[model samples]
Structures are given as structure tokens and as C-alpha cells.
Target: MKEPAHHIILDAISQSASDIHFHPTPNEVEIHFRINGQRHLYKKIALTKYKVILAYFKYTGKLDIGESRLPQQGSLSFEENKLSYSLRISTLPANSLESLAIRILPQKDIQSLHELFLFPNQFKQVRKCLKNKSGIILLTGPTGSGKTTTLYAILKSFMEDNNYQTITLEDPVEKSFAQAVQVQINPESGLTYDEGLKAALRHDPDIIMVGEIRDQSTAEFVFRAAYTGHLVLSTLHAKDTFGTILRLLDMGIKKLELEQSLLAVASLELLPLQLRKFKNQRAAIIELLEGEILSEAINKQLSPLTAIDFQKLRRKAFAYGYISEENCF
Candidate 1:
């Protein structure tokens, strides 16, 4: 049973799969792997064999094996051929049997800012925002859109400089950095984002990274941290730069506060690149808003001076032959 389980996970890593899905039915279990924004069927196993594999995974991942009725999450580290990988495990109760999903995080896959951005101008704009000593820079994207990866790259850049004190508040602390202090948020222990931010402030951190701004309280706390002369970087879920502003407003943040400390907004989307040019599968294209352009956006002033949006980025990608026409939509 353990041999089969290890084989499945090692196969996923070898294929550069970002996620693996195990859908169990009454008689058998179906397996699928997601790579480069596409999913493909991998294999199937008998229900009897799958049960043993599931039990082994649950126990190794430190999750309660008896809790089949409720959803659960756990994480574990795996090593194969001297390569290290982090696996985030999640199980959900299905109609007949529990379904499992694993997110494969490769420790060696970290990319620098220049490597991640599709355009040099976009990279320059982001660097300018990071240079600011005090302001809030928000990154917006959906899940699997490279938001967290971008944040990590930026944090790594700062860490290398050794000029400022950096701290991060992440839910599960995705990756490890030796230069920066990372705090994992555990609600069970009363360590919420708001509480974590307050504690981080006392350390006189020059830069703060919030894993995400998920609620009104966290949003307000981020703004407060920005106002107090610290650079705050965070991610939000929105479609575009303007949509990110609307989300903050809808979250009960005052427009005046936004106008004062908001430095820039970057909305990112990943598109599959032409296979022949690169070894990696996908790259990020960003829609950026900043400076007077951001002020105009907050004021609802539509002008030609506003920064480029996602639609424009998509058109450029299509024209440059970096992506296919069907992907432009």
C-alpha cells in the first residue's frame, strides 16, 4: 500500500504536477493530475487498495483517520532522489467515499521577479512600488494565479538586501526564509491575522507581508499598518486593478483612507507560454495601476492616462505570439 502511494506522489512530482486529485466511488478510485493549468487522467485503483492508501496517507499526514464525515486538512514533506517537496493534503466527504486533493509545492521551483514577469516594464513598475518605504501594495488574482509566488519572490528580494526587517503572516507558512521572520496563523491558539499584525508591529518591522486580506478586520488592520509608516504587501481576490479598489470599498474601507496610503495595485493572470521557447510551462502577465493613475481610478476619473489593464495585456500577449488566440479571452 505504501509503495503504491509513494509511486503516485513521485509520479506527480516527476510530471511537474501542481495538484493531484483522488476521486473515490463505491467500487474504485479515479486519479487525475493538474499541470500547467490543464488536468489529465492518471490512473485508477480498486476500492480495496485505495482504502489502504488513504489510511496510510492520513496517518502520515497527521490527520485523524477516523474523521470521515467532516472535511480535514493536513500537510507533510516528502523526499525523492534527494529532491524535497511539500504536500498540502485536503479531504472532503463525498456521497459514498471521501475525496482527496493534494497540492504539490516544490521547494526548488521559486522564481525571481524578472523570471516571473512577462514584460520588463511591468517588472520595473513593481520594483518601484517595492522601493517605497511606507504604503500598501495589493496584488489581486484568483487561486493558482501565482499571487503567493509573486509575494514570495518580492519578500526574497528584500531579504537578500538585508536593509530592512521583514515579517510575514501566513496561514500555513507556505515556504521558509532564513532572513525573514514568518508567523503561522492558528485560530485555535487565538493567533488571528489581526492579532498577528498587532504583534508584528511591536517588533518594528520595516516591511510586512500578509498572506491574504480575507475579511474587513484584516483589511482595516493592513491599512492601519500602512498608515504607521510600514510597507505592507498583501493579496486579494479580484478580477482587475479597478475591481481590487471596489473590493476594498465594499469591505467597508473608507475612500479617504485608500487615497492616502495605497501605493499600487497589481492584478495577475498566468497564461501558458509557447512550449519551444522555455523549459517552464507558464508565465505571469500583470495589469498594473499606480501613482496618479491609481488616484484617478479611486476618483472614478476615466482617462487615457490610466495604466494598462488585463484586456490590453491579453491583446499584447496574443500579438506577441506568447500565447494562443483562444487564450486571449
Candidate 2:
């Protein structure tokens, strides 16, 4: 079918496509879309048509169309279906031509915590941390493990109950919420993560969400925001909950400050390819930290105990994903 690059993108959003891919093949060019976290073949199009789509994105989004040596980034919005997306574009070295990939961002919709199928124990801790008026809650997990969705769910809960100024500083501003203000970090305008976070604080927000805490400035600022009485919810790139402590310490946050300001850290993992069930569904197994044990561990600057040993402790609670009665004493 004949379609402009912008219109093709809008059609993908209408189909609820999560990811789009562009690649060249021996006979023809190939396009793929990841739907519901699984990759599916979309269609094969002619080489010239693919080039037009890439040029369209490069030109309209003000990307570096002339530069074949460096990567480019851009975004497109579709108002008719209330959908938006950000694209990352780059040229392949061998072909000396541009290619593209797009990540979808759906506008926010109301979804309850229970709909995610949380274990009772995990849900209780998550609910407690989110319900608190002021504190820093860290959700750590590998990429594509639903960490962002959990954060969105928490924000949705707050939006349903009362009116408060909630702001999120994300690299691409993935999802939009009705009652919250969202800002995109623009490197071209000197709006790095640190800059965006500083701007967020000046707004006197009731809640602040930092997309990812990579360094000392953001880690320290988020902690300070929590200590100063703003509810902070954000994610970290680490193996599990315990590793989150080590990561902050590595970034220059003191142990005492972390213990004082940080409310909880949750680690999650999406089961490997070997564990996926019969249906298209995938499950996230989560580990949560809280209470006195968590406090002492952070205060002491303890390295996370081994996962093998920690899983043994998890055997004690043995219900939900955390602990179960049959496996416990």
C-alpha cells in the first residue's frame, strides 16, 4: 500500500504496535513490529519506498539528513488517534544509507494495580510505598520488564484520589497523563537530566518522576527532593533491589542519606525465553525491600547478599512471588 511515513506511523499506533523496525533484505526490504512484546512480521516493501520514508522522517523532524556518518533522532505526533511516538534514526555503515526504528507511546489510561497480577505480599509493600505522602521509591529492573508501567500505575492511583502537581522528567516523555505535567529532556537546549530535575524542583511539585538516575547529580537531587517532602518515584538500571543501594553509593550518595530518604527499592526480572508460557503472555517476578531490615542494610552500606542466598530468605514468606506457605517452615 502507498502511505506517507507520518501516516504509516499513525497506522502503527492505531494497530497498537509497540516497536517498528526497518531493514534491507536480499530480495526486498523488510519491516517488523513488536506487538504485545513479541515480534511479528508486518510486510515487505520496495527499496525506494523505504528510502522515501527515511528521508521523510529526517526532513520533517529536522534530523541530520545529510550526515550519513552519525546517528539522528526525531519524534512525530498523531492527533487524530491521540497517539505519539519518538524515533531513533541512523545510517548503516555498509549500505551507506539511513534506516529507522520507532518506539510507541500511548496516552495514559486508567489501569488498576490488581490488573497487573501482583503477589499479595509484593502488592502490599508497593501500595504502602506509593501511598506515602513523601519518600523516594526506586523500581529497579532490566529493560523491558514493565518497570515504567508500574510507575505509571502508581501515578494513576494518585491522580484518581486528589489534585497534586505531578511532574515527570523523561528523555522522550513516553506516556501522557491528564492531571500531570511532563517535560522532555532536550540535549540541544542544555536540558540534561540534571537540568530538567532542577527545573522540576522549582515548580514545587508534590511528586517528581525521574526516568532514570544515572549519576551523582540526579541521585542526590532525587534524594533531596524526597527528604524535602516531595514524593519521588523513579527507576534505576541495576540487577535487583539490593544493587540499587550499591549503585547510588557508587554515584556519591551517602549511606545515611539514602537510608533516611529512600523508602524502598524493588527488583524485577522478566522470565527468560525458556520460561515463557504457552500463550503470548509473559510474567514479571519481583523482589521488594522494606522496613527495619532494609533500613539497617542501607545504613551499614552493606553489599547486597548473593541472589542465591536471598532467594532462600524469600522462601520464608513464600506467597505471591515473594514467599509461599508450602515452601516455608
lDDT of 1: 0.87
Q: In model 1, what lDDT does residue 191 have?
A: 94
**Looking at model 2, which ten-residue stretch has the lowest summed lDDT?**
271-280
Residue 327 in candidate 1 has what lDDT?
84
Candidate 2 TM-score to native? 0.74
- Stretches of candidate 1 exceeding 4 Å from the true structure: 301-305
Structural similarity to truth (TM-score) of each candidate:
0.92, 0.74
lDDT of 2 by residue, 229-300 (tens): 888898888887777888888899987788778888877654322222323343455777777657766877
Residue pairs clashing in model 2 are 317-323, 318-323, 318-324, 319-323, 319-324
Which number leads on lDDT? 1
In model 1, the clashing pairs are none
Best by TM-score: 1
